[model samples]
Target: MKAKNFLTTGLVLLATFSSVVKAQVAATDPLINQVSHLLIETNKQGLVKAKYASAETRLADLIKAGRSDEARKQMSDLISKIASDLATGQVKADDLKNRSIVTAKKLQKAQLEAVNQYVNGTLSAQDLVNTLKPLNSHYTALVSVLQRYQDVLRSGQSTAAPAQLATIKAGVTDKSSILYARFRLDLLGYSNDTTKDTLTDDLTQAITDFQKNEKLTADGVLGSGSWKVLNQDFAGQISQLRISIDRSRWLPDNLGATHVFVNLARQQLQLYVNSELSMDFKTINGKLERKTPILFDSMTHFILNPTWTVPQNILLEDKVPMFTTNPQKVLDLRMKVIDDLTDKEVDPFSVDWSKVTENNIPYTLVQKPGKGNALGFIKFPLTNPYSIYLHDTDSRNLFAKNDRMLSSGCVRLEKPFEFAEKVTQSMNMMNWSADTLKDATENLSPEAETSTRVKLVKSIPVYLFYLTADVNEKGQVILSNDNYGIDATTYDIISQK
Candidate 1:
């Protein structure tokens, strides 16, 4: 009986020993070691694991507590910092920790202020909730991207290719890219319902919309060019815009309560009244060579029966040849040859066109404004040596083109009539109605038959700005194309200061 009991005890001890071995093997598995290594590296890199989850929870709590601005500011700062770090280098763990602490304190202060403001009826509960929604959404996205990036950096044995890294960075801030993504999600909350195929259709629609807006050939493929633009660093662009804004600080602050604002980069115009956008429209900018100047000035007067005094350069280069080849061409085009001999308009057909030389052209070519005239129907006269005035163009079709650099040096406004009307109305001008304007235009003749001047009763200010970035009402920054290639030159000038 004693021998049998001892044998049983030995067998039980063997079973226990085998269980310990299996547990040890499982702990030391290669996959387990790799995962452990990833977590450690991620922590060391100052990447917070479960960042999305944490951020979402925090945002929810903030919203519930009615701290919208605080949440927004925090998320904005956080994303900005992450973008900066990605562009530069990894942020120090200590710095991040310190920043997080500082942010917490700020949030607390903001929360108290918000609560007080709410109690005082400064902000309604619904307003507070509405404001918080964007902040919460932004934070959620930010956290998601950051965590995904961290995971890519950690789990993936290989580092992301330079191109991939660049793409990721650009996607974070590019409005076009974000809008495209949002469109793909149909602005509907992301769902797990794949079998319904709604996501695919949504993505297709998103691509089409993006292509249409960008003025690209609307093939549904999201090509590299589109992707590159989508991934551009908007924070950098905003910084650049800030630099431009500072450069334009030399301009007068009070451009009047009503004025026109043009952002060259975005190729847009906004007519503002008392600091609100009364009207907005698309615009084409100067081409590469004949780029628009960045300056501020006011329109003093509108010349309805205006005359286009041919530019000296055009006269010297273009007219000289044309006059020599066929003087009748100038005559037919309604250009009066101002004879240097008499300082008066000479009949182009009667001139001895063969004798005219480059140095002694002996006359100025002036085109009296009329139907099919260069200045169209109106000209907004301003003081500038470049002869760059805001003027209507007979070639209205040029405005429809993507590259609107056809002008010699003048600004061709898309809606010049409406624009002029707005300015005139703002100035409290007399008899400046559409009827009066129509009468003046119809009666416009080369004889200067009437004093067709829509003189401003009060002069309104005009600012020719070059803003590359502008924050919309929704707080999203809008970027524009650098048509003039002035971004680099402007950036250099700004950096020096």
Candidate 2:
């Protein structure tokens, strides 16, 4: 069998990390030392060895020296999470299945008891390590996946040599040209043999799948439309896809059969129902100054005609002082001051005017439900710590902009009410599906000036991510611009072999 020669010298050179670049991280690195201190202990037993042995040896060093602030935070989160799961117990089958490289087999009785001992502080670190030895599979999976993608790129398997090969079809006896088409199909994960050179039934169907995804004519023919994309710089884009796949390693393999998937890079949200694409919406995410962190949480419920309570940070930074100088401005907008905890109405005059600053604002300022609420008429709330929800925006015009990353951090949905309605309808467990919605008052009303919390009968998962390169419905490899400049920064860490 003739071997595939795909790796260009340039790609191999680009893929290899320099020794100097590798040495940026030293033993004295603060974060590394911090991770070490947690993993290492004197005369440790059970908790510190074997299972955690991988964590001790690998987790800290997984992060490279030139890591960006966002990448640093992500790495810190990964280590902290591993430590947390280790300290508690690893239940890999739950929603956090992707938290490690490989899935640890179901725990046996003795292993479970050892973990219990660690939880109660009765067992040593090595004890914890030995008991949760399966947790090491997470690192193994991570390393293996990372290595596989890097290997594909390093071997020059993804890139095709410059060629003006003749257009080839399934029945045509064009072995050499067929090899070129077969090569691309393989890189994109459709396995076919280019060495055969002959277009087989499998290769034809593979091209059809690729063409269907690419939104081209799926006639089992390789022509101009398919040829142009086939010869483009897909090798680089494959690396981007690998990064996205790796990110999912921290999430459930099935991100909920029915859930909302938001791609921060594309500024788009995809609603999936039974694994089929249902609705896709344009989303405005965080600006660079207030970059949005990727989040995975369930959509427990939605709020209708919801009053917008000004968040503490926004009140301090933008509103409090603005209102202090011109108290009438608050009244003009129908904004009310409310007690922080109870959320009951409070008079603006009851507070000392001089004491209100960004750092010292005591009361919550909320906008009434009419047209002026920053969170349009409804909100789809994700149960996350960030308090970032998917909400409608007063500035619908902003969606037309090419760069839709204009929000502080929460996503601004173009058709938020529609989305909320769809979700409510899906949750037939609730009495508030759109058909019953008209009679159901406070289902996110346009007139309620105060906040109203509407619960769902069934919870839907929401995954906020930045997948810059993805295979779209057209099956074409689409790569969006790195809106937050993350791809360049995190490339080294993710791309390392």
Candidate 3:
């Protein structure tokens, strides 16, 4: 497959680190020695080793020539290269999976030592800054998670093929498939009645739980989606890890003391307060065709009983045709058509129905908030080019499904009022409490003409990310469905051989 230049921007940003180390300390300084040791250790582990040799040689030459500035630049460039390679998993080892784990851990340890040395005043601030400029929080988290992933790889268990699983009878399947299923379930810590050859009631419950954890239908039966994730080979799983790691590296090291994180891959939202996991809940993201963009922004405020203005695309594709077919459908849904220039509600029946094509529709459709409203009862507005936000949905049944990618683009929260209360308290919004928000929600009515807007005194950071692989509390690898196929596409681009 042809490779896309998606890494071009990242590489350019990495190159900007060339000037980060401006320290003119002598070549014989202990800080220089520390950097040299780090380089040697990194090379020994074959962590993107080949590309750094020339830079290291140049740095050595500069040091020997008493050119401290040049040496610092060379060192910074080399460190940047190492960081870039770590982020991309461009390992040079013959056995990538096992070798990458070693390299990642070594680099992680070296980074920590540098940080500690700086705190102890053994290393200069300049050197420490340059050393850590590239290794962000994502890099540290990725290294830790990658180490845990090794357990899955080391299990050495093979899953049944899709074709084989498809042919399994109720109680007559071969033991090999059953054993594979049991071993996988056991590995994931959802094991039950392993002594039985068939999928007993306990084992079925385990499967149901596993399916729910993986964000799939909890039918207690192994379906195609379950097999697809279970049957991923070691290399494929590693690719997913690498892809998620690289994607995470794009985010800021400090996400903030209190922030909201939406992992679209898992269809989950987490609220962190003072860097602690405060709460988490199920969220419905955009559909595959209309994917919710991966981005970060400050959630400035939330609207109670918010109105929904149909976007141009949605207007043209869905509403125009519906209104054209049956004009009464507009009032039936409590949507008002306002004239573009007059700023006044236009009667849908007054418009020339036959002439009003999607392109010729000169009015905007705004859905009033309340029962059956698209935006539901609340909307957490975020500043992003995609115009995406966290919102409520009256169709609460959608949350019960494993796959909740059912929106146009914005995120639909299962518990919007609860989320708003937490955000308000976390941000120290004045004159509001959990019970206050609850009362407002309960009192809100379909006939409410205007929404109650509450702007926070300070905005809270929010990140919409897509990470396909994560570790559970037990440190077992939990992989989610790559509904957007981003993992496969990005892995192909970055892992090009």
Candidate 4:
């Protein structure tokens, strides 16, 4: 019966992908018409070179000659090329179907073999479940990704008319941008009705919802930031989805029983315990110019009341200018400049402010460990060449903002103490609880300026990845804001494939 069930499930999963592709292909004539129209519309918007760069000169010449029949034939040929490319994808899907069936049979056969070990009272139930959990997780992730891919393909077939929206705020009445905003918001599932184009209260709320999801400032105004995201047409969205799917495949099949996954695109961190979500933390990542690198490492340790050593870039660009203008800022923050050669603290008041330059900086600026410390109270260091880590921040007000990409390179946690407690419990650090950890710092003297570093018994795996698209808990596909424009860069390379 289990074997039969496995066969049924496999068939259903494959059918879902196969049916969607087949249905789209079945209306080949309409599909061609749709493609032709899309090409023309995109060309008008100077986007012809995106996918049809090779055919651009020829198509242009044909259009110039007013050869309607030949132009249609040329477009038909292009469509055929696209169809041929997609057919290759179908072949790959068919190959996956075969492999899945074989794997399912092998799994069923292996289970039957394991039944004998169970009958002999050798294989325990918990052990069996543990063995199967990774496989189950792998299968679930695969199916979820496949579903998202199919949904994206289907959505592309129903591209809304291209509408360009200009910057506008609330109470803006009867403008083309307003109309476009309404339709675009409605299409994105943030709004329901597009019949009303004016910036009504309903439209304002919808824009606000869209802004929040996109990680933009939720001011409920259709400004440049909002328009930038809403302007991603069907082709651009499809390209993004393709890139996301390819990147998703790069992740390990099993991300361990316990791990930390950071999505740089969403600026969020997820902690999974026993392969189940334990906690979700809002994070403030790096700025657009200073991007947080995508990497994989293990969190080896965390510090309590961590002292912040200002990086060279920060010193040169931010602090030096501030200190040059107003030296009092350094004294207020309890910042000290240490001579790099002598390893001794230098008085900020002794240095000539106007003479200091980035190239001639001879001292390292370090902030003392206290309430005013930049690295707040805790710091989780990861083993990476980028020198980026997850840590607490003194700027708590930044968390309240909808758009929280305000860091230099490191990630700032919203709930650092809670995260520390979870990490402590996970490592089973000898009798250490959140309260005990708090107590360690609670009694610190004002003159004390040392950080306590607790090395983990077992390092927790950490993955810093960028994914612009994700499958939500409810099985719905959602898009994240591409703050770093990494998606566009990645799509350029993957589109060739």
Candidate 1 backbone overlaps, count: 1
Residue-wise C-alpha lDDT for candidate 4, range 43-90, written one tens digit per residue: 211121234444534644565566756755765565433332221221
Winning candidate number (lDDT)? 3
Ranking by TM-score: 3, 4, 2, 1
What lDDT would each prediction earn against the true structure? 0.49, 0.59, 0.65, 0.61
Candidate 1 lDDT over residue span 277-392, tens digit each: 67676666555555666645567789875678887777866676787788778967777888877898877878776666666677778886676677877888776555767777
**Which of the predicted structures, 2 or 4, would earn the higher lDDT when compared with the native?**
4
Best-to-worst order by lDDT is: 3, 4, 2, 1
Off by over 4 Å in 2: 1-235, 339-355, 429-452, 494-497
Worst 10 residues of 4 by lDDT: 97-106
Model 3 agreement with the true structure over 132-213: per-residue lDDT tens digits: 4435444455546544444444465443343476422356466656666666676555657656777577767777778778
Give the best candidate by TM-score.
Answer: 3
Residue-wise C-alpha lDDT for candidate 2, range 246-269, written one tens digit per residue: 343345445676888887887888
User: lDDT (0-100) at residue 92 of candidate 1?
Assistant: 21
Q: What are the candidates' C-alpha RMSDs?
A: 19.3, 12.5, 9.7, 14.5
- Return the lDDT, model 3, position 474: 43
